[model samples]
Target chain A: MTLLKNIWEWDKRNFERLRRFQLPHRFKQIGFALFLVAFLALLAFRFVNNDATVIKTSLKYILLIGLLIISVSKEKIEDERIVQLRQQSYQVAFVVGVLYSILILPLVNYMADVIFKKESLGFEVNSWEVLFIMLLMQWFIFRMMRKKCS
Target chain B: MKNTLKVERAILNLTQDELAKEIGVSRQTINSIETNRYVPSTVLALKLSELFKKPVNDFFTLEEND
Candidate 1:
């Protein structure tokens, strides 16, 4: 029991330490700039050479990394309340993102199949797309909650 | 939980922004606490108590639902 208690304490201490792991506030702007540039590059690549799957995949990963930087960066005022909101936003976004993948995407695919009067195209949602959705949703919900609280 | 933070701040003639600055928090945090939309952590509650020069219980009290 003492050994188990020690392990629990160590885990808790590490978790608390993780709470302080955030980039400085300026990284938020830099992250957004990176995301924007990668997004435009991806669009231009799609227009120019849609067959370059490797390059497209690489750009998508860069976009995901940019979003991750933004998500993990501190706000201008890194208060406890903002931290709480960020946690809440992440939780909500994960649930919503899963529901979107399981329910909304399939529903849309079915609707498209019916409307187009074509056979099912077996549309698959990419993992990167889901991550993008979750991050965007988290940001939107966090901003809305902040605005309402303010 | 409910708190008399707004009333206490008013008595001291301190705006939300000023109180937040004193506590090293955002103005929105003060607003959230005043509006009863957020319950501060023990550290924050202690900070407020220290700032107001009162016991934590003087400003913060438990509701029956809490």
Candidate 2:
């Protein structure tokens, strides 16, 4: 019985360590994910020397799809605090997305005029900006409203 | 977030998860309510009160903003 109790306590400690879902846990996962992306991006940039456009574009598209999948987890949100945070986050993201569009509009037109020589889908790189803004807004709302609800 | 949930659960000695199952919510939701993380809607408040064998007012009290 004593041995069993000690084993149970050890197992509980292990579980807690593995399943730590606080802010630092989420941040660590995100940091690791970003590092993986940067490593892959560097590899893609280095390896495909010839016919750069085809391979680089494909790599960018892959990253685009990956980012979309990660951000699309918005569909699975279930917590009320998270939902409340999302509501305010969306409000800010909308404003920030619009502002981002405005800031990039001139650059986009210039890129079209000088580089691509016409309108193109280069603006899709705004995915990270949108995700960042959304997360920032969510955090802001969570911080602002968390106390009130409590 | 203020609720007569403590009184209701106390009468039966039902755990938060058991009460949540009875009301068709996740345990986290019941915990949230008990800890004042979220306030239930009028319908849900009424349901809880009914389950607790109490009046809605007895189960839920309103503050100025809430």
Candidate closest to the true structure, highest DockQ? 1
Clashing pairs in 1: none
For candidate 1, write residues B1-66 as lDDT tens digits: 889999999989999999999999999889989989999999999999998899999999999988
lDDT, residue A141, model 1: 90
Considering chain A alone, report the TM-score of candidate 2 relative to the true chain A.
0.41
Q: What is the C-alpha local distance difference test score of candidate 2?
A: 0.62
**Candidate 2: which pairs clash?**
none
Where does model 2 sit among the CAPRI classes?
incorrect
How do the predictions measure up, each by TM-score?
0.86, 0.49
Sorted into a CAPRI-style docking class, model 1 comes out as: medium
Candidate 2 accuracy as TM-score? 0.49
- Residue A89 lDDT in candidate 2: 54
**Interface RMSD for candidates 1 onward, in order:** 1.0, 4.1
lDDT of 2 at B53: 80
Off by over 4 Å in 2: A1-51, A74-82, A95-150, B64-66
